[model samples]
Target: MTTPNSFLVISALGKDRPGIVNALSKKILDDGCNIADSRMTVLGGEFAILLLVEGQWNTLAKLENALPELEQELDLTIITKRTEERTPSSNLLPYAVDVVAMDHPGIVNHLAEFFSQRSINIEDMMTSSYAAPHTGTPMFAVHMNVGIPSDLHIAGLRDEFMDYCDGLNLDAVLEPVKG
Candidate 1:
């Protein structure tokens, strides 16, 4: 009997600057690996990158070996982990929500706390902020896709979220995720 090989997920974090992507992608290309999916962003002046890479199990050592030099050059922390095969979902219903408010601290933290309490899983999230040109005040926004269990009541959840939003001075809208 033989065990099956698996894909790998790579995540890197460090201060935001130029050439981070170039350095990492060069290493991947030199190792003959392919990037299946990736997301890179600058969050609060720190650069974060998440990548799903596919290659042969025998080549894993090569990929691991290439990281140290890049880490030294970019002053970054790199982590690579094997990915588990995803089981098919039967009762998964997708939900999406948008949140917008005056820029303030603890917004994401508060929303995440609420979601965790309800066992809601966030599949994807994008957050951004900008200054209003006229007033020079900041506006914040978040758009996220979440998974809702079949047992939860949507109306009750909405009401609960509304109360929280009122307290935070934020506006939230929840809707079904459509393809």
Candidate 2:
């Protein structure tokens, strides 16, 4: 039989600071848990953390109980919950999408809504706004990794997406991701 509560997904969000990672890593190690996978980034002045970890039942319980104190001490907001190990699937092919346009509100929402309506899954996305080198015009850019189901037609999809971008005066490209 499988052991109870042996794996967990932990999320911590707070103001960016110097010691967040170190403190969390030290505590996790001290409690005999292994961090299986993690991603951390600073977004809009807030630090966000995501972690997948594995440990024994008591270890999980201890961490669950101990996190609140750490959260309070560090001024962090955290969520921890049990989860099963994930298995990879090959049903979808990876694609890369890049977008460029003058900075404006609703561009991100529109793109995300378009993908959502088409049942496309975005595995990762990064966006930034910066000034153009020569014109000094504010520009927005997005780079995304998407998973497209094998049965979907690529050419028509890209054409439609690009057409939509064209209406917004945005330049966009979608292509198969290279290893």
Evaluated at residue 97, the lDDT of candidate 1 is 84
lDDT of 2 by residue, 1-179 (tens): 97644788999999998999999988898888989899899998999999988899789788888899999999999999899877565988899999999999998898998889999998889899999999999999999999898888899899999999999888999999999
Would you estimate the TM-scores of all the predictions?
0.83, 0.88
lDDT at 50 for candidate 2?
Answer: 95
Candidate-wise lDDT, in order: 0.86, 0.91
Alpha-carbon shift of residue 90 in model 1 (angstroms): 2.7
Q: CA RMSD for every model?
A: 2.7, 2.2
Clashing pairs in 1: none
Give the alpha carbon lDDT tens digit for every residue of 120-169 in model 1: 88889999999877997899999998888878898998889889988999
